[model samples]
Target chain A: MIKIKSIRNKILVWVFLLFLAIWGGISYATFYQSSHEVEELFDSELAQAAGVLSQFASVVDLSHPMIDPKLQKDIYGHRYEKKIAFQILGNNTLNLHSANAPTTIMSNTAGFSDQIINNNLWRVFRLNVKEQNQVIITAERYDVRNELIHEITKNSLYPLTLMIPILLFIIWVGIDRGLSPIRKLAKQIRQRSPEKLEPISVNFEIPNEITPLFSALNSLFGKLKAAFERERRFTSDASHELQTPLASIKTQAQVAIRSDNKDTQRHALEKVVEGIDRATHMVQQLLSLARLEPLTSLDETSDLNLYSLTQTVISELDAESHKKNIELSLDGEESIQIKGNQPAIEILISNLLSNAIRYSPEQGHVDVAIKKVSDRVQLSVSDSGPGIPEQDIKRVFERFYRGQNCQHILGSGLGLSITQRIAELHNATINLSHNPDNGLVVTVEFVAKN
Target chain B: MRILLVEDDPILGDGIKSGLLQDHYNVDWLTDGGQASQALQTDSYDLLLLDLNLPVKSGIDILKQIRKTGNALPVLILTARDATEDRIKGLDMGADDYLTKPFDLDELLARIRALLRRSKGRTTPTLTHGELELNPVEHTLSMSNKPVDLSPVEFQLLQLLLENRGRVFPKKQMEDNIYGWNKEVDSNAIEVHIHHLRKKLGNDLIRTIRGVGYVIDKQ
Candidate 1:
């Protein structure tokens, strides 16, 4: 699996890029609007200046004679005023001009136009003075107008340039503060020991964004604690149950050694063997219970015939039931095939059958049947034994819980638990009920495969 | 001394019974809690050795019932549960002592002897009456400081009578103490053992009251 990038870094990078894009767009719009407004303002000023010059020219006397144009200068004129020059054109001749004016008509047009005078580009606005029968042209260089536009844009953008670093710093701090709860939670989890399964408490108030995360983690801790508690109880109970048989074996061995009579010694020795067998059975059952405890998936798959499987388990237990004079029989649909884990299904069948045979009275009957009911394959095992009490039926599936009625019987009490676990693995259901006459009927139903 | 041993496991119960018998104490072994409870209600025993996990009824329930009836029987709980909480519960429920399973037989015998001694209102394991002295632990009988040999049954009979001096024991009770449930006894088995004990310990040591039973005088 690829390592995921940190949420904090991702948020920071994306937000910063989005802010930079928005700021750039706004700055471009502001520059575009102000530059257009400045160009229009400068054009109006040139028109007004041309109109005033035409009025001044119409007022001046030109009937005497045409003379060479003299240098016109204003003592109070600004430095850029030198770049603005005008001329009066009468009948395609230069009549009057400023100091920077060329000795030629700038434009023949009667409105604003561009002209190259003395190899320099100029913006000339011409006006018609009808009383004088002449046109007055006001011209300014292209470089001067460009220079003024640049100044306006620079002054307008100065604040935004300075605000960029400050905005980024504020965002970085805000993200850090917002993510502090998650960091604290991580630190608390990292410092915890495996044995300590307590729920973590964030010392600071959790932000809304990560509250669900914290709650989920706490719930997981709760489940883990419960699982650990269950494991501990199982280990303790298993040891205690094993200790009894071990004690019996030890005490019986002592009895054998202390006995002087041959018959007594032999009896003690036989008891020792019985004790060993009981302990071995308990250990085997404990191992089976442990194996089924973990929720591991069953890997083995095959088509299992319930009727045949029941028959095989019954045959294996034939001698045991025979010793007690109990009759075992199987009656059901032949070749009832179901898809399942073969060994797990076999174990499930074996436990139910053996339990029935073990709990039945002498000469009692144990009947097993399998059938297809609706969308399910149903298997039922009923035995003519003293049924469990009403209160103990629910507790029978718990590990090491023996019914009060069946205390005389030898059992590790793990059979039903294992059976239930296998049923769960197969997505099946098992139900137990007291027989109407005097026994228990266990029904296991598996979903039928098409 | 007679002990009522209520244990569910057959092998362990049988082994304990055999060991107690070897020590010259009468033991009536029972494997069912209900049956043991019935015995406790109907009969008299010196000490009760009860196992916690039993059939039909649990050992703790039986002990509680016994105590509720004002039966101050010294009970020693024998079980495989060694948890501290279990031990405390057993003791708090009026058990005189608690012994975990897989226990040493020697330790069990020692605890039994102590309980028996405490019940009889005595501290020593040795019983003495006039010139006769008996060491219950060593299973020895001596008269006037000289060792005497006695059969196992005769020794057990003499020990019972000596332990409960001045208390009359009928023939049936005496026979029950001397023989186990499986043992077959002749009609005159108790009389024959009494005869052998009188001959060895002297006739005056045991006084047989007419139509009652035998008792050893405290004097």
Candidate 2:
């Protein structure tokens, strides 16, 4: 059900999907890497600023009862650029310094401590301040680093958001333009009537991938043209061949009507009747051949009992063979089942049998046999009569081709042609040869399904 | 026997007219489709021989018009188109028989006779008068149920006679029903076959109208 008509559309769809996956992956990786990097830089800068301010703690003059405005200015100045703050803890009493530090200081007896204050995340480092036995806790606000990362990420994502609609638009337009030639070809095919079998002449400058499609279509059209020509030629030739005998019959009948004498009139009319019979026979054969031309494939999978079909064909021709004193026998194994189109196989066998019966001399024997090999079923018809010449054997399968020596025989020469076509349709082959004593032998072999 | 011949070609029309005249069938022929349609509307011909392909109107159209008016006239289609679809179409359009073109004159005459015999409702009911009896359903004829042995052809002949027992049936109609539509019968085959039937059924059953044809006159 998946027609391989449009290769470009498939390639474009895959390409667009791959682009989407890769773009998403790269954006996520860069965003995660930059955010982690900003967090690490913020941590290291806070620790270094706390170290620089600890050296200035020796000048604080802690024995003073009240806080010094000079010390506050000194600490605030040192930590101004890095947005750092600190708390000085002495005997469970706390003194906080810096612009944004809360009035209540954190209890930090350990080396370093980090916590959130007033709904703001803070990273605080605890210093011992060994001279006073007081804990020096230093902290920095976290929103500054986060704000920088957010700005950088927002700038990077703006172009990607804008590209989604543009990418989809390009894919749609590319697929439509790529398949335009296919639509043109479909329209060209639809414009043709059944009687017209001309090849498609519309050509476009396209990619290398499209050449195979064009060539495939060209070859199919070529075959269709040839088949139409063959059928038209066959019909006209058959009409010409049949017209002669019909014209003769009409002329003879008119002549009989004009004649006054009874004997002459009766003789002319009798000749006319014979001509009419021959014409009718020829016309029937021609029509059957025409019908066979359009049937290219076989209904080989049907539940066709070949034995019954063979019996029917034999019975149809039984009366003719009885008058000729030729015995038509069906020799085959019971339940010789093979899968093939029944009607074609019947026509194949009938033509061979009729040829055998027609060419055989009076009282000569015709043997029809069927056998099943390991993987194939073989049906053979051998006649005891004058055989086909060695040179003309190949030519007999061609349309309207008859052997030179068999010119005296009553045949239109389409029988073997139709039989060969049927054999080709079934993927079977006809093996023809001359019988050793005097006659011809033709065999059709069918491939077994199992 | 009178037949309405509906054909297109002038030469074939003239030839068939003369040919039917020789066989003692009074032929009123029309060469155009319009004329043929008009003739069927007014005339009481024993049979209608129609060609499938014609100018101004097709044979199928004409046949459809005939059947639409509930006219039970027997129409035989004679055409060059022998495809299965065309035959099915003609028969579906209420044609009694289909004969392809370039056919034998004898065969054509025989088919026309067959259609005429069938048109008279010869096969629809059992015909009985006095000691003579014929059963259309069983296709058997008997004199007082004595089991008269007859060939298939002779049985059909007796049935044709018994169906039209009260009328003078023509010789051509008898040959058509008995010999089929394709067999080439000479002019005398009908006469000879009727003679044979008379011999078997007793000579008093059939009467020969001189210079015309044999007839099964009604008792």
Candidate 3:
């Protein structure tokens, strides 16, 4: 199932093929030059042999009946040596000939010529010795010169043929040694467990080419470790928050069961119901916060009217505001549009509005506005309540961080956290500030779609 | 026994206070750290039930401050943090006990009882002076195996004096121990409670040191 093209295999194949091509070219050139030099050397030897024969004719008595020269075997010559024959000619007569020499002249008046003698092609070199008034013709078979060139060519190619396999082996080993770091890195990764998100150690030496890869992998591990730690902390805090409410409910129910008087029992039952309601609200908020945390993509978004969304949230929270006798109103641009997920945006606005209403004092006023400012749509909710303290303003977006001034309020402290998460999902920015008049003002700015 | 319950969660604090009241323990509950710190400095309590998380000041800081003042008040930490490190930190900071939230009502009561017993330098849950035995859990008193009925105030007064048999308790201290901060006590409240205890348990069982206070001689 592994479909990777290995770097080691690629390197081995390419380098071997290149080495073969270069070696083949050098061998061919060596064979060709040796063949050419051998041919020229044998040709020159033929010419010099003709001149020596002419001098031998002068020393011998040519006027006496021309005696046929006996064939002689040279003890120092190789077994495949070609026969060299020469004839001395005076007044158009064959004066001397070896045992294998042709009776007919090989070539007439030639410096060097090719001819057939005794059904074999010969390389004939003729010299006219004017001092002795004789012509010397020295001839060697063409097959003999060709055999010499072939032997030289074969000898020159022998070393290259032996060196090719050794060169291939060396190339393979060199490539493997060069690419060992990558293999080691792959093995190191394969040996790790899924839960082991610790950074890979850089203790051993590595090549410069693969150092960046290691650094990137280590950084990725660091990020994954941090993400897991955050998740763990969130789960622990959530369970802790849930346990408190459940403890309250259990204690209240116990109180109800232990009471002998009806009034005390009824009061205890009321508290149990209240505890359940608070726990349910906290659970719902926790679920909303969990859902909002992973909404990183905006694929399910559409053009939403901020003004209408603000009005809908305000209307939904009207009863809550009325219970506290707080005045709630929505105003500003009528139809400012931004692209966002409707439910996410609704949650974002509802959290802000509910938080404002929950913290606002009796008879306090809450104002909501949606306005188009430049290229953005700004949705702001201002409440007349005690705002967060200066030190706590930065941590309001953290889950379950209730402000010092508003701890008595019935809240799970996840409202602003959820709001911040949803805003980030829709590529929006949220800001919390103290209202100059009183209370806190929360503003969410979304980039305009159009 | 008088107990100071410092918790930030209103409903849980109320539930614990009501539960403790049903057992006839004088409980003064404070919802924030600032007031709880102030109360601990100005008032006296047999034991302290401290919650680690609070609004203005954290419970740990109050515990630290209490310890810093060299007050060896028995502190039971009631927290939603069940981590081992948090427990260790609380105990290392001079807390006498640690309890995580969603705790059993019986367990909380037993821990409070144990803390009170430990603070009074007693190993048993029942207080005894000679033949009179006061069982706090069962809310019963017996002299030589015969049951005796006493009102809640008389029972608390007898339990306090019997727990510290050799030591004398000033009248004001006894009154504060029997009543919470919000309860308004008449000037003769302690005297009436002491008279009722003497009537139920016998005159020699309760002693009045005139200018000092009341004390039961160790048997």
Candidate 4:
């Protein structure tokens, strides 16, 4: 249950444990087998010893080895015979015995029995010979058989216990060798500079288990390179666009400084102010567009009425439309709900409305419509102005793209691009279609919240 | 000097035109490349101030056309594009010089003067004839060691005839150069300026070619 954090340690611990378990099983089997063989061999030896003694008693013909069963009590009275290692007893009497055996009979009747004689346990066996009317009592030390079994089992187990530490060291070294590729990869990554976005080549001698890891990391590096490239291009293009108006401002300010007449100086100063305003607006638009790039989704949103939002944006641009005498009118549904962030959606609506107003000619008409088509809420703004040409429409959403026809119009050329981005933030679809009646109709569709 | 200014930006073009007028040079400003190209072809100008970015046509194409036709009209590229490659392209495409936008008015005037001087195959900034010295940058005329005070038109008339010493200019052409297309001029305006120049300097400096035009002899 120890939570090993390192792969090397985990492998080492697991292999060591498996080795110990297998060794323990094999040692147990060996000991069991050895013990079984020893038991059979010892029992047979005891029976053979008794057989030898029985033949010896048949031939000796000494004082009738055991003549009376009543004489065993008299034999127990002889304490001096306790030191004998063998004994012969018959008919409940012991007539002859070795010094290690008890003077009394071990058993009155037995084939094989375990007895304590002179404070030592023995394996005793008896054979009764009816032809001689005698019993051959043979006993061997029981501890001797156990001691032999113990010796064989010890030989089998001693080597396994002594080898545990050395085997652990071998396993540890093996795991370290196996994980060297990972260590090499870590060192390579650590030595790399932060700006090194180039993809790492996977043509190293890495293991098969982590080759996928290298491929995934390389793909990430590729993505990072592309992102950095995109960011560089964006900064370059943004600076280029910003410099144009700044150049205008600088030129006009210098002109004002050198102008001898009040009228020309006033006019130059006024233009300088206009250029400042235009630059400021362009900067705000640029920041807004830049901010929208990293937002994958909106965090705070509500079910907004698309009709009401359009009305609000129209009212905000009332003065601008009035300057051009554009007849701005709203149509279709009074209320249609869409899920979106409020400020983002407001910017979207405002950009569209202002773009329409900016492009519309004096006394021209602009139509703002809100419609709920199935599950989608659609907002369309149409203007009676010079619509985009067939070729320019595709690039209309590119930053700082002012159409050839739109060059005469006063614009920073970031309006539609911002509008498109805001619409994208809301997961809405924006479309631009050329009107046959010499105008443009822009439609934005959002999924209905209801 | 009469300068043809081609710029798409309204305020910048107006400021440039106004600034040029204050320097006593006749200036005609057009807002786009197409109009400027047509003017370059049909009209005469001392120099062309061209903007690179325009609606109908780019100034590069106009420059290519002028160079293709072997016209040595001095063209100065005035643009908002400050990149090294853009400037190189503008110059290599037969532009006399290049100037990025938001430029100093003084530097613009100095470059224009230099370009005009170089176009006339002159290295120095001043036009000289015998004992008369005309400084275009300072807008001054001197007889021997004394500076002469002359009106703007008289100064222009003297400068035009002096720059092209042997060539004779008709009354209409002189009038056109004295006053750009933006202005209305009296029919005898050039004669009045010539008479004023004669009175201020000497009658022998500018000659009347007996109903042909005015000319300054090569001294």
| Residue pairs with clashing backbones, model 1 | none
lDDT of residue B81 for candidate 3: 73
- Candidate 4 DockQ score? 0.41
Error of 3 at A420 (Å): 1.9
The DockQ-based CAPRI class assigned to model 3 is medium
**Model 4: what TM-score?**
0.75
Of 2 and 4, the candidate ranking higher by DockQ = 4
lDDT of candidate 2 over A1-450, digit per residue (tens): 555455665666677788789778867876898899876776676666556666655556554435554566565444334456667666556654665566687535454555778888777777776766666677776676667777777778778868876887788787788778878878877876648768777867745666688778778888888877887766655754565466446745875776586975786677677676766767666776777777867645565555667778888888778878887788887577767677677877788888888888777778878888898877888888789878888788877666756644556678898888878887788998777876898888877655
* 3 against 4, candidate with superior lDDT: 3
Per-model chain B TM-scores are 0.94, 0.58, 0.96, 0.97
Ranking by TM-score: 3, 1, 4, 2
DockQ per candidate, 2 decimals:
0.51, 0.02, 0.65, 0.41
Model 4 chain B weakest lDDT span, ten residues long: B9-18
Interface RMSD of each: 1.5, 10.4, 0.9, 1.8
How would you encode candidate 3's per-residue C-alpha lDDT over A424-449 as one tens digit per residue?
88778998887887689999999987
B60-103 per-residue lDDT for model 3 (tens digits): 89989999999999999988977888889899999999888888
Model 4 lDDT tens row, A1-450: 778899988887788889889888988898899989987887786678678877777677556544454554456553422222456555546767764566787755668787776778877777777776677776777677677778898998888877888889887888888888888777766755547777665456878998898888778878887888877767766876677778778878887887777987898899999888878988989888878878888889988988888888889899999988999999988768888889899988888888888888899999998998999888999999899999999999987888888776777778888888888888789999977777999999998887
Worst 10 residues of 2 chain A by lDDT: A73-82
Tell me the TM-score of each prediction against the true structure. 0.77, 0.48, 0.88, 0.75
